[model samples]
Target: MNKSQLVFVPCPGMGHLIPTIEFAKLLINHDHRFSVTVLIINSPFDATYNAYVHSLVSSPSPSFPTRLHLTLLPSTLPTNISQHHKGTFLDAFFENHKPHFREAVSNLESGPDSPPLAGFVVDMFCSPVFDVADEFGVPAFAFFPSGAAYLGFLSQFYTLMERRGVDTTAFNFKDSGMEFAFPSFLNAIPAKVFPLLVLEKGWESFSRNHARLHKKARGIIVNTFEELESHAVLSFSSNGGIPVYPVGPILSIEGPSNPAQQGFDVIKWLDDQPPSSVLFLCFGSLGYFDQVESGFLDRTAEVGIVIGWAPQAQILAHGAIGGFVSHCGWNTILESIYFGVPVATWPLTSEQQINAFHLVRELKIGVEISLDYRTGFSNGSKTEVLGAERIEKGMRDVMAAKENEIRRKVKDLSEKSRRALAEDGSSYINLGRFIDDIMNMK
Candidate 1:
């Protein structure tokens, strides 16, 4: 085995951090020689969150191998960026930190306890790490913690820019919508149905980072199975020859047994609900749904419980979870399918909307909200939200007897999801391959 190690740099937020942590754990368990260290970036972690993570890393239990380690870097958002600002604060945060990040990487490379810095596995959004990897003479791979279908959408960004031009003035291309259709895994979404980052005013900061990172990365890794998105995943690879690894259905990677051992009481409550009777709703940490949105969900309390953040894997593994009202992030999608729960999607930002489209259009295991992405506010600033009636209705349709067929189909998909991480399943095989590749790297 190669003496070099695997280093993961995950951006802040549970959506990004959880998957990377799981991946690191998987690598270490498979081969002790392959050490895994997770780098936490820019976190103002409170006692509760930090303690939870520390417990996982320090647990002397059999669940985690001793080789897994975590390093917390000094993290602080730029001076002007705080939690409350919604509008342009995101852009401002990125603008302020890009330069400081370069120096941080330089310092870490030379810092004590740094391994040979074999390679970097970074969140798709943390593109700046690609530059740092380049500076340190190591290959960096952007890990899209979403589906293969969504990664295919991003792989086409450069082509879309050239064919349609940068202005997005042609956004109203109803006439040529079919010409730019997304992958079959994405369902019925037109190429037009993406987030504001694709259509925002000018070389927006997010868009710039995405493009630069795509150009810099040695490869791209998506969290999905080939059987689910083979055509699109292949097309993405064929287009740029950008070696795509569809190593996913990650919820199944650790085993059919749930990895979330901490939340036992929550699992018991979930089991009390009837089959397909509950709806799991979560929007990661970065997502902040306002009181209006919260109230809408609260109104549906008679039908299902809506906790701020339920133990996702445990709940999905429960018998009562019939459907999901998810933000369509990658981890939720994979977990829901792993447990065979159908989805009702209302994706907000990042790769979510694209994921939502595929869940409804291609997979037939979910429902998508009829949101007007083309006309919505660019900054996600909005006073109004989907009403309780819509939420309740969508939930009912998914849980109804009339939709038994939907449940059956999703059940079948879940079987496939499980198989994907089974002994020879796609995800299982890919994970083994990844371990071997990284371990053998010279």
Candidate 2:
């Protein structure tokens, strides 16, 4: 009676690693028959990342049924790879790590006393591992850490580009607002809200390779609940080639609270604020507050609590947090929604632009700072610097009583998000279905 083993390969970033780890915990908790081995690609720049992954295993919780094991592979790229490609290092890094990844999987499979190999679960960035999974006669699942709408857009964009023969990189949106039809959306997606990958250089080849690899996967998993993105989830699930499962808002109920911050000064500051009176602004890992113009900071400080960094999940869950000024990363969007905090959408890079659109337009849970704002991707496009006035106005709009309806809507959705992860909810059922599908794989 050996337990089944599922190998997970997550891209070398906190954003990808967090959700993938949570998903693994979900699988093991849902049923005791599965164990997860996460293969993490060593980060040359961040020496602490591997240590963080190891901590998850070392610090086991009594609540979870099983512990996750982690293995750190050697750095696949030279130390100076970032100096070469600059912003496009992720695209090149994943492509270069194929050999290292394949060898690691082979070694794991050949080890004596190994549990029966159930399948391979890979981050969307590591889709190249599909071939390795096929070699071992196991199913490979693509885990998308973002919303279903972004996944739907990725799946449909390449086909649309081919059909229209439009070079997205060459298209200019100086004065006119260009719109394109997507099956996932009832209305057309404006050029301003298109993913930054389409606008960035050197991403065309990477995106094409990603799309091809995704199509080869046996199934796709997204970090969104069906109630949140019904249309987009249906679009991905109906593809017929690869089955798609919506099994998320897969956040840790315990939350990622920093132990050191228990009695910290920031906690005192938050305690002093009135309930639902503060606004929390957090971008993802690479995000920085210093990149913002000085004038914008001066004005925002007058309106809200401006801290360098806080425990985001804890802050969002706080009674003092009324609104969020976010870069609209999918994780942040989900967290804010979970806490019933409306957002002032200011998308920075990657699929955030599309997520911003969904937050503001579709979900009606967020207000927009600017749809045309682009930064952090190094796409040769001039970075849009928002002035103090615009920033203040956006903040005012999000926190004002006029936005009470939006707040009420998000509060309702937050309850639904929680229920979706409960025993008989949509996400819970989908996760069980996915696990059963893996067990049935022959």
Candidate 3:
């Protein structure tokens, strides 16, 4: 039997690429009959990502049964696209790159000695390329690198726009305390914490197109486990025309080593702290702390350790790190959860605010810092500085002796997360089922 090969196309960002790669490793680890070829769309802003992808391909994981392959596809977005109309640039960028992506897939399919192309697994941002998968008669799956709740919300929002002709962007400007109910959440979601995409120009139409493509996918795979977002996963699976698989918390156990870790005195300092005593603050690559608010670090240095950058996975897994003050990027959240670290949520942009809300309110594994922090496309005002009081309060809440319930819940969830990747576990079984579905496609 010819080995089945799956093609993964991840969006240009490190967050997207890392999980897609980890998912590929998961697939190859669970079943020896498969191999993966990752097609990375190189980003001009992050040139180092290309080298990182190359390294992963060249140095296959020692644990996985098969090695994953990689191909770097040139980004088609113009350099000037970011200078103007930045809100819709991602939608525009992916649209422009579709033809090139299509050509690349075509060439791969026609090559001699190529494994049978089982299917295409594309990042959520690369939904437009489902057409490319169609051209070659292979199934395409949408890999959402976020939570199932966000997926459920998107599906629900799309339906509202179609049926009621509602303008979701208008919700952003509504009364400050207004909340809207979605099928996925038990409580109403505040407009402030809703996805930033709804407020972007041309977002309604872009989202409509995305929603249509989502339904057209062979299946939608989310990076969450059934235990974590049971209701949201069920809601998404029941309503979407396509099958939705909660097959994740798929994370790299050993992340790429941060070269900046060498001279950073923070790691040495962390070694001196008592176990579970320090709060670690990490905003992702695109996120940053305001200069004015940087003084909060000086004030709280004794209680916390702030680093500009560190090996996040390793840091989260550290014994001295008790709490995470995060931007609530899905990857960062998962890593924190996997390491049994509770969070103090400080959402910055994108779906992060929603993720933060879920972590603090829904799951009760994290404490809230400020849901009102203004950032992202919708906020054109001056950069909102996080007050020291709010920061200090969040730190206290996460580290409080009375908050052991939060700690206990996160620790239990961390074990579940580990088990979900084990043999016959939820994520393990779902991944196997996903692989079988692909193999049957051939």
Q: What lDDT tens digits, residue by residue, belong to model 3 across residues 68-183? A: 77777766875676464554566677778877877777776787977778899998877678878888899999999998888878877766554755555674452356577888
Model 2, poorest ten-residue lDDT window?
Answer: 376-385
Clashing pairs in 1: 186-358, 187-361, 187-362, 188-361, 276-322
Better of 1 and 3 by lDDT: 3
Compared with the true structure, what per-residue lDDT tens digits does model 2 show for residues 309-356? 467887788788888889888888888888888999877777888888
TM-score of model number 2? 0.89
What's the residue-level lDDT of 178 in candidate 1?
46
What is the TM-score (0 to 1) of candidate 3? 0.90
* Model 2 misplaced stretches (Cα beyond 4 Å): 44-51, 54-65, 78-92, 171-176, 253-263, 291-305, 379-382
lDDT of 1 by residue, 209-298 (tens): 665555777677777888777777777766666666777765533322224544546677776777767767766544554554678677
List per-prediction Cα lDDT, in the order shown: 0.64, 0.77, 0.78
Which candidate model has the greater lDDT, 1 or 2? 2
Q: How far does residue 294 in candidate 2 sit from its true spot (Å)?
A: 9.8
TM-score of each: 0.79, 0.89, 0.90
